[model samples]
Target: MSFNNGGYLETDDALRMLDLLSQASGSDFYMSLESKGKKVAGEIQTLFSDNMEVLEIGGYSYVAEVASAPGSGKGVARGLPLAVVRDCDAATASIASLLYSQDSDLIVNILVFKAGGDNADRQPFFEIELTGGRVSQHAILTGGMPKRPCEIIVFSYRAVEIKSAPQLVSGIRGAVRSAKLVNN
Candidate 1:
């Protein structure tokens, strides 16, 4: 659908469009995209290029512009554990705050990826990656009332372009979440 006459998307319309896109492409596609903390510019042009309806949407240009901007996907280090939280809610809030913060780092997004190898027996290990935060130093993940140090493990990094989105979702997520921690 096209934007309103003002050339802007309303919240409801935007949400609806996202719902349609997610439904059409499947949650697994979005989950994979979200997991890797990557933007959908590539997919829009490649995966959905054949769909005339999707191509007609005017918002794709903005997505591509944002993705190609300097320091767009370059600033935030992937898979850097900032701190430990009491629960998942706290973690979500922390990530949101960082994304909304006005720091020079301009954090665009935050993502969590599995750090454990293909071992179901291992605990559900994961790490955080910041998309556009200017982290100058490495920080440890500490939390709780008394506060204790959490062990840091080797994380995965996406060294090459993933050719198959469906086949390499898990591998991509794992790799995208493997960057060393950095702090401002």
Candidate 2:
């Protein structure tokens, strides 16, 4: 599903989350935004056009575009959206369980979200895309909003070749571990 305010994240938080994704995937990132028709989405849409230019933060680049609303439901999405409960330790445990349940070598696309303060299912979050066993793309909504999506940040990574359950577990563990550090 498209992220809600409970899943929202600020620009700085999104970038910090990117650090975790980078650590887990062992790569930098190519970042962009996909407008989901929210208020901030409009601000972003007005800032850039299809043929203008992209902005660079730290070292990575970001491009923005206006788009239709993302489809509904969890599976309407193509990636796995992970919300950490209690702490990253809990997240790691859940990731382990999820990997073990899967039965094949797969390319995992995880959208790690930091839930909203009141609840974990709101909005205002960023997303990442993983393909070909590396972090290739990231989607984020950023502006000077009054509140952030969550204390934890979303971890976006690309196609991690989980050849075995152990590898899958380790990759996600690393991502969660990095998130723990970032969260604290």
lDDT of each: 0.26, 0.27
- Model 1 worst lDDT run, 10 consecutive residues: 55-64
lDDT measured at residue 172 in model 1 versus the true structure, 0 to 100: 39
- The deviation in Å at residue 20 for candidate 2 is 2.8
lDDT of 1 at 36: 30
Q: How far does residue 22 in candidate 2 sit from its true spot (Å)?
A: 11
Best by lDDT: 2
Using TM-score as the measure, which candidate wins?
Answer: 1
Off by over 4 Å in 1: 1-9, 18-62, 65-91, 103-184
**Candidate 2: 10-residue stretch with minimal lDDT:** 37-46
Let me know the TM-score candidate 1 reaches against the reference structure. 0.25
Cα deviation of 169, candidate 1, in Å: 12
Error of 2 at 63 (Å): 14
